[model samples]
Target chain A: MLKIEGLTAEIDGKQILKGLDLEVPAGEVHAIMGPNGAGKSTLSYVLSGREGYEITGGSVTFHGKDLLAMEPEERAASGLFLAFQYPVELPGVGNATFLRTALNAIRRQRGEPELDAMQFLKLARSRMKELSMPEDMLKRGVNVGFSGGEKKRNEVLQMALLNPSLAILDETDSGLDIDALKIVSEGVNALRGPGFSALVITHYQRLLNYIVPDRVHVLVNGRIAKSGGKELALELEAHGYAEVAA
Target chain B: MNAMTSNAEAFLRRAEALATPAWVGALRRQGVEALARSGLPNRRVEAYRYTDLTPVARAEFGAAPKALARPELPAQRGRARMVFVDGVLRADLSTLPPRPLSDAAPLLGTVENSATAPVAALNAALAEDGMFLDIPAGENAGLIELVSIVTEGAGPIAFHPRHVVRLGEGASVTILETCEGPDGVGYLHNPVFEVVVAEGATCAHTRIQREGQGAYFLSSIHARIAAGGTYDNFTLNAGAKLARNEIHSALEGPKAACHMNGAQLVGQGQLADTTTFLHHAAPDCASRQTYKSVLTGNGRGVFQGKILVAQVAQRTDGYQMNQALLLSEDAEMDAKPQLEIYADDVKCSHGATIGALDENQLFYLRSRGIPEKAARAMLVQAFLTEAVDGVADETCRAALDEAVMGWWQGVAA
Candidate 1:
């Protein structure tokens, strides 16, 4: 469902993703583990089509379409989702309202009828209950004054509502408590089926124990140096990436 | 100085013909003389540095227009109605609430002292007709709407519609002052509103300015709140070639509170200014002020606010904030927030910020499948919602919200 070949990206004229290649077929989850400066976040940003990153030499294809040429919104419309590590606080834009706008924008692009306020409220309320999120959060500004764990859960909640074909989880487990991690993992696992794919990026092997990725790849200095199965995550966790990359 | 010679003389001559009370006439002469000496504030004056009055000063002044023949609008219902045309009151179109003068006398009792404000003096001197609303002691009126409609031809027209609202002890009311004009007309509207809230009284005064683009509007609302009284006001400016709104409030009694909030949306070379002065005179009074402006194209916005705490006003709490968003590089914003406190045990603070849209927020919205322009518009709207929500009246707040959105549409297009 997704493929990246020779992806060379730089930020502020400093190279980050140098000649990177990755592939994730449908109905599977691929885990990308790396050291602190492994360009894990950069890969997600590039794939999500964020600006200010110069893609000097690379090709990213999603579902047979050139993802590199599309705008961020176009990528989202084409079913690409990024769960940010730090969700931005948009004051005065209600949480529910923001979600509804995003949902409808994607729906409009897919030639689906937009949901009205009542219908959206119903759908959102039910989802909030399932995710164990408080209803009051929907009334407040988007991510404003939210706890770290709450922000992660809110991101997952959005992914569930958006139901994107391919999801990129960038440090979703970094600031989460054990309970929040479990809840987020459960949420992702529930959506695991045919036609669903995800690139789970993390700094540790903790999240992998819950989601249990089908493949593990270690990224160091902007390039994936090693690849293996689920046991590789545990191996790296026990021995560390310093020896593995060497 | 050259423009003031002939213009001042003509205005004085017109004022001499009015049959105003002797005291009021003298005040008018004083104002005209002061204006003559000042000669239409220029850029040399720090307060008017960013705003030039050359265009307004050069326009020839004319007599107030006759009252329009249309029925009163539904929005103008309730509250006393005062109409002005070309700097004069159209008494035929106004309705005064019945009252006992001896029992329900005005709080200030008609400007007995000489005035320092030239324009206010001029308004009071050549005054036409005004409304006096005296809320009986311990009474509450939901909302009072004051509609100031300007209808003039090519020449400049000025009107001073004086409003004296006195809230008796424990009385409450919300006053909405709206300034509007006929479409496609070029005119000037100068209005003054004075309010007094008595002990334990509460008053919320809101002003909406949506005049014709060719119109030059200047308005001043001077309010005085007594001990234990509360005053909340919000002003929205969206129309006019150049518009200025000045609000001055004095908390004279202990435990009094005042909240002054305003928002101005300018587009396509438009100019709008919101100036506010808050004074704490008694111990334990509190005051807060917030003003936000959104400018697009070559539009310009100005905000000047000051909070003053007197020596006896101990334990005073005052806060003021002003923020501006410039949608285009050509757009300009001038903000000045000042505080003057003579009391030792007072807490006072002020802050000002001016910038373009947030790029990070823009990217976040765009990445969610929202178009760039729509995302920018949403952010701008959110910036304005802060000040608009400060208005206490729901209907009036909604109306201002719609007006801001409409202005955004015109500017974005």
Candidate 2:
């Protein structure tokens, strides 16, 4: 349920995503593989509506709506979620409190009743258990002093709670160990359903082994240079991006 | 021809009208004389260089109105209550422990020894009533609350509420001082407080300044700690046309400790200043000071802090840091942190930083679907949270945190 056509984007006057076109239909998981400076992360940032990026040209549609026109919070309310590669550390905002505020903000935007503190606590505690995160983490500041793996797991925990219609994982596998990668992948795989869609961006194919993709797109030099099946990820892991880009 | 000339004369005339104790009146005269000798401190004066009180000096000021009804404490309970209306104490509206103090005499016993500083003397000369608490030697669980409120309009009003907290050996106590104002005509509030911690004692003091926007507020806190004593002070300044909080502490004995932390948010023409001076007078004393200021619109913030160590104060450890975040192009912040150490064995350092919101941090939060305003507010709050979190008392911490959030909402709106 996501479409990107001629998505040309530049940051600081330097073009990163030049005329990139890709689509992920409902219920499918898409993986974008690329090397350094290939604009894989740029697509995720642009899709998330971050400021400072000049969208030179192109349009993005999510669930039949103009994704490029919506504000970041509007995109979030409309069921678009981005799992940042390097999770930010909010020193004074508790993890659970932050999640609750975000959840209510989105819910309010959707015209749903906000969850009370007690209600949120119960729901969050249960979800934390599912992700193997300690109850103490919920009380601490978001991602502050957390291990890299813990931060990644915290992201998945948020994904579980938000249950967005479309999820964008920008190198969620980076800095994560094999165990963390599996846990994160499993968390994503568990949310896969007919109503959900995902665009997973990564440099290596190791993560795909856990969360297999329905389609593979190789982004090179700011555009999607190759499109193939799930096997394409395995082939790249063996041969690397030089062969594909060349 | 200077503003201080007429202002000082007006202050003296008002001081003459009050039927103060002879000694108290004499103290006020000394303050007036000091003002005459050193007309409102100018840029040449090191401490007043960044913060010019000339504007306040130029304004015609009159005596504060009589005491008003005490403010009702929200259901939230604390240790003790001391009420001040205008700049005078309203004992009728205050509550204190019934039994007479045995460990330390009533506060009146120590009143005469209090200093005659310009602000302190002015408060003492005009103050009608106030609370004095003493924690007996080895006493446990002592708590005090000072509630200061402005009720009426009487030109520029100033209130000086003196607090002498004497913690006996090994005693502990927490003091919460909240400054508020009624929705009356705008006025001024200047309060002075003093705290003393005895050997092996611990004192936690918190000050919350939430005066009305039209009010001019100034507060000064002076503390002295003995050997092995600990003093912790936290201040939150949210309201006022011009608000200044000054904290001065002296570590008098070996191993005495002091922690000073404050957060201030000023918006739209508001001026808030936090000036602190910490003296390490004895060997092996440790002191730390951290302050954060957030300014928006044409708001201005000033932070001036200094750490001083004496030659005999060998092995002293002192650290001071001040940071400011300017939220708007028009917003301005002045930060100066100074360190003067005479003992080669002393360890003292100071740092000051002025910056705008971190772009990377902003983008990181906004990308998560949080609104730009909400994201910026979150980051700003986070920046100040460290100082607030350092408060030892949870209730006080929660109250200060709420005050911070309230200020943010008001300014952000």
Candidate 3:
């Protein structure tokens, strides 16, 4: 479902992704593990069409469409979702309004019917309950004063609601507690299907234990250095990325 | 200066010929003298630096039309209303008639200063008719609506309507004042309001200025709060080619409180200004001011707010914040917040922020599949929420919200 070939990129005149090649085919989740400066986040940002990154070389395509040529909203409408590491706070925009607006926008772009306020609330409540998020979360401003776990769960709720074909999870477990981790992992695990794909980027092998990827690749100096099955995550966890990458 | 002088001279001639009560006539003469001396304020004037009155001076406005059609009014949101067309009271459309300003002479010109506020002097000089409400002691007046509609005529028309609301001791009232007209009319609507909050009384005043595209809406408000009294004022400036809403509020007695908040949505070919002067004269008083401006498509917005705490006003608490959002590269905003304090023990703080919509926030919204335009509107609305939500009256707040929505739709179109 997704492909990247020699995806070299740079920010502010400094090369970050030297030469990266990776793929996550239809119905499977691929895990990318690396150390602090492995350019894991950079890869996700580049795929999501974020600004300030210059694609110096290589190409990326999603479902045979050149993803780099599309705007961020177009990417989202075309079934691309990026669960941010640090969610932004919108002080006065209600969480529900933001979700509904996003849902309807994607629906409109995809030539589908839009949900009204009441219908949206019903859908949001059911999703929130599944994620163990409080109903009051919908009434508050978008992630305003939300706790770390709450923010991660909110991201997961959005992922579930949008139901994207491919979601890039960037450090979703960084600040989450064990319970939150389990819930979040379950949320992602539930969406696992033949038509669903995801690129899980993380610095630790902890998240992989819950979602259990189909493939694990070690990213070092902006390129894939090693690829293996789910057992690779345990191997790296027992040893270290330095040994694994070498 | 010469052009302004001629303009004032013509108005003075018109006022001198009018037959009215002796006191009213004297007030008009003083207004004419003041306007003749200051001429219409230009860029040189400190208060008028950001808002030039050249357009008003250049246009030769005739007296308000005698016969005219009553424009469609907004849905009634107040218990009683007084409707004025071109500054002339339309008794046929008014549900509650007002007493003449003659009975409220002592309170009429007591609160506002004509020297600094030339528009107040202008209104005093030429105001033909206006609403005068006198709430009795301990009486609850509920909600009152003051509607002013400026209709187009054969030529540019100018009318200065004077309004006064005096609440007796322990009385309370809410006033929703709206000014609207058809689009693309170069008429002038200058209004002045004098509000007196007696001891232990409360008065909440809201003004929505949705004038026509080419109209000049210059308004002045003067309010005085007595001991244990409270005064709240909010203004929404959505329409008008050139608009200025100036307010002067004084907390005159111990434990008096005042709150002034406003939002200005200025679009292309529009200039909106909100200037306020707050005075904490007595001990243990408090005051708060928040003003928000959103400028789009080369529009201009100005906010000049000053707070003064006297030596006797010990323990005064004053806070002022003014923020602006520029949606286009050509849009501009000018904000000046001043604090003059003589009481060393008082607490006063003021802050100002002016910039484009935050890029990170914009990108975050767009990444969620929301279009760029809708995302921008949402951000702007969020930016304006604080000031608009400060309105204590539910009906007034709803009306302001509707007007903001209307303005947004207009901009989007």
Candidate 4:
């Protein structure tokens, strides 16, 4: 579903993600495990078409379309979603409005009919019920004054609504407790299908246990150095990134 | 004579021709004299530095034509509705006719000091007709809709409508006031409001100014609150080529409170200014002010807010915040927040923020599949929602929200 070749990116004068290559075929969930400052977040940001990052060289393609050539919104409309590590707080924007706007925008881009307000609320409520989220969460401002876990759950809720083909989970489990971790993992696992794929980016192996990945890749010094099965996560957890990376 | 002198003379001539009671004539004389002294305020005046009224001084305006047809009015939701056209109360269109100014002569020109307020002085000099509502003690007067429309005219016309709202002790009322003018007409709509909130009473006033693109709107509101009284005011300034909304709220007795909030949406070639002054004169009084401005194209926005606490006003609490979002690089915003405290035991804080839309927030929205234009509009609406939410009345809030949405659609187009 996604492919990258010699992807090199930088912010300002400093370089990050130096000539990294990776790929996730259709229906496979992959995990990118690395230590601090290992270009995990940069890779996710570069893939999502965030500004301020200069693409020095290389290319990324999603579903046979050049991802780097698209704008952020176009990237999103093309079924690329990035769950931000630190979800932004929109002070006065209600969560329901944001969700519906996003869903309708993508649906319009895909040549589908848009849902009305009542239709949207009904769909959102059932999704929230499955995720064990409160109905009041829709009434509040988007991520404004939300708890750490609540923000992550809100991200998962958005993922469920948008139903993207590929989602980049960027350290979404950092601030979540154990119970939240399971719910978020279950949310991701529920979306596991032949048409869905994800790049679960994390620093630790804690999230890997809940949402088991088909492949585990160790990213070190801006490059993916090793690839293995699920046992690789256990190895890294037992030994640590330093030993496993070497 | 100079342009300013001619402008003042024209209004003075109109004021002198009105055959009213001796006290009313004296008040008109005071107003004309005040205008003659100050003329049109320039940058030299500290209070009027950001806004220049030279256009008003240079223009020659005629009286309103009596045959002009009234435009459509907003849906009224209140105990009664009053419609005014060209500063003349349209008794045929009004369901509740206010008492004549001669009846409220004692309270008409007593709330504000017209000598220092040029626009209020101008309004006073040429003022003819407006609303005068007097709620009796302990009476709960429901919402009242006051609509002012400046009909299409042959030439540029100027009108000054004077209003008075006096709530007796323990009385309460909510006012939804709107001012609109015909497009392509270069008229002037200068209105003055004097409000008195008696002891233990509450008064909520929401104003919406949607003047024509060629119109000039200059409004002044002076309010006084007695002990245990609360005065809440909210304004939405969305239209007019040049507009200035000035408000002065004074908490006179102990435990009095005042709240002022407003939003201004200024587009190309438009200039909107909101200046406010809050005076905490009694002990344990409180006041809050929040204003937001969104400027696009070559629009300009100015905000000047000041809070003053007197020495006798111990334990006074006051807060003021003014924020602006500039959509274009050519757009400009000038914010000046001042706090003067003479009391030792007072809490007064003020803050101002002026900048473009936050990039992080914009990207967050865009990354969620919202188009760039839609994302920017959503962010701007979010920025303005904070101030609009301050209105206590839901109907008034809905009106403001509709106006805001209409403005956003215009801007987006």
Tens-digit lDDT track of model 2 for A1-246: 898999999999999999999999999999999999999888998998888799989899998999999888889889999998988888877788788878887888888999999999999999888788899998999899999999999999988888899999999999999988888888899999999899999998989999899999999999999999999998898888989767
Whole-model lDDT per candidate = 0.80, 0.80, 0.89, 0.89
Q: Give the residue spans of candidate 2 off by over 4 A.
A: B1-7, B16-20, B64-76, B97-130, B153-155, B182-186
Clashes of 1: 6
DockQ of predictions, in order shown: 0.76, 0.52, 0.80, 0.85
Regarding TM-score, does 1 or 3 come out ahead? 3
Candidate 1 per-residue C-alpha lDDT over B295-404 given as tens digits, one digit per residue, 9 for 90 to 100: 88899999989888999999999999999999899999998888888999999989999999988888888778887888898899889888888887886787778778
Candidate 3 stretches with Cα past 4 Å from truth are B1-7, B114-116
Chain B TM-score for the candidates in order: 0.89, 0.90, 0.96, 0.96
Instruction: Provide the lowest-lDDT 10-residue window in model 2 chain B.
Output: B100-109
Distance from true location, Cα of B171 in model 1, Å:
1.4
> By DockQ thresholds, what CAPRI class is model 2?
medium
Against the hidden reference, what TM-scores do the models get?
0.93, 0.91, 0.96, 0.96
Estimate, for each residue in A1-246, the C-alpha lDDT of model 3 and write its tens digit.
799999999999999999899988999999999998889999988998888999999999999999999998999999999999998899999999999999999999999999999999999999998999999999999999999999999999999999899999999999999999999999999899998999999988899989899999999999999999999999999999988779
lDDT of 4 by residue, B9-127 (tens): 66677777876666466567778888887777877678889899878877778866768566676677777999987767888888886677677678877885742489898887877
How do all the candidates rank in terms of DockQ, highest first?
4, 3, 1, 2
Tell me the lDDT of model 1 at B111.
33
- Fnat, model by model in order, equals 0.65, 0.54, 0.72, 0.83
Instruction: Name the docking class for model 3.
Output: high
